[model samples]
Target: MKRAVIYYSLTGNTMKTAELVAERCGADLIRIDMVKPMPEGFKKQIMYGGMLATFGKKPEITGIPDNITAYDDIILGTPVWASTFAPALRTLFTKKDIGDKVSAVFTLSGSGDNTKCLKKLSKFCPNIKNSVSLSDENNGKPQDNKGLLEDFIKKISY
Candidate 1:
């Protein structure tokens, strides 16, 4: 399958995980960048960005491929915010018809709580084949959860 990994990262963890997924799956890497940056600082970020995601607010994003049909399967990744996905991803999904094309979903959660996040994403991406989440300590570092990532990829890609 022609797979693509589309993701957004604020602190590099999601980006690192996305890179690994792309490399291992031999998928295209499409990074989502916001036209305007979010607020800095943890509290500010959680309050501002998190609320935006919670409220289903789509931020202005750049770098979303104009043609999303180039890939047969797509894997989405983002850092968890307010028990949900990033606003940038919300923008992409809202603007694009990515429901049936999504093959899998992955997330980087600092608090290790992503059940609701996964459910919310699954709502928009109904055809997902698999899903996984890595905690703060394990999200970026391959050594921490390589086995888990491999298992996730195997279930979907292989």
Candidate 2:
């Protein structure tokens, strides 16, 4: 099956996981880049200024692939922000009609509740067949947990 792993990463953690997932599944990888990088102190702002933006929904992605329909499977990866999927992903979810495609979501965070994030993503993509989460300990770096990720890819790719 033709599959693709698309993700947005702020601290490189999610990108690392995306690469591994793509390699394991033999899927193409796409990186969602913000036109302007968030300010260096944006994390502080997200905390004090109310994480409303982050937790509310996904933000708009500037350069989404025009031919997303070509892929049979999509694996979305993101970092946990304010206990939810990053704002950028919420934006991507705005585009509907993905019902026939297979989908999965994965998250990487230093510390946060991944269950809530996955649940929220499920709402956006109701057809998601499987989902997974990886903490800082298992993210990016090589480890014995590769088997876990490979299993997830196999589960969703078909």
Candidate 3:
């Protein structure tokens, strides 16, 4: 099955996890780039806007890949901002045509709150088959989570 791992990262943490997931799954990887990057102090900026966006459910993604029909399965990765999925994922969900594709999600955070992001994703992609969350405290190393990611990939029967 054709698969793709797409992610949005303000810091390197989420990008690192996304790369590992793609490599383990032998799937294509796409980094969602904003036309205008967040301000220099992105962490602070995100912390402020992220809360409002999460509460309001407003995603501000400016772009997405034009052709998403090629992938049968998609894995979305993001960093937890204010205990929720990053706004970029929200934007992707609002703008993309992800109908019928098998989907899963992974989140990276200093603490554990996988359920929040997964729950939000469930609302966007109701048919999502699986999801997982990794804590940054576990050494925050991509290699450490390889086995778990590989297992998740194998479970994606699509």
Residues 1-158, model 1: lDDT tens digits: 68899999998989999998999889999999889897889899888887788788988999977677667889999888888888898888878887679878888887766798988888888887788877787445444456678888788766
For candidate 1, give the lDDT: 0.84
lDDT of each: 0.84, 0.71, 0.71
- Model 3 ranges with Cα > 4 A deviation: 57-63, 99-102, 137-147
What's the residue-level lDDT of 60 in candidate 2? Answer: 51
TM-scores of the candidates are 0.90, 0.78, 0.79
Question: Compared with the true structure, what per-residue lDDT tens digits does model 2 show for residues 80-136?
Answer: 876777777666666645534637888886552488777767777777778776777
Q: Write the per-residue lDDT of candidate 3 for residues 12-91, one digit (tens) a residue.
A: 88898888778878888888755555667867677665764567555456546677667878888878777677776666
Residue 93 lDDT in model 3?
66
In candidate 1, stretches whose alpha carbon ends up further than 4 angstroms from where it belongs are 138-144
Q: State which candidate has the highest lDDT.
A: 1
Residue 25 lDDT, candidate 1, scale 0-100: 86
Kindly report which residue stretches of model 2 are placed more than 4 angstroms away from their true locations once superposed.
Answer: 48-58, 99-102, 138-147
Number of the predicted model whose TM-score against the real structure is largest: 1
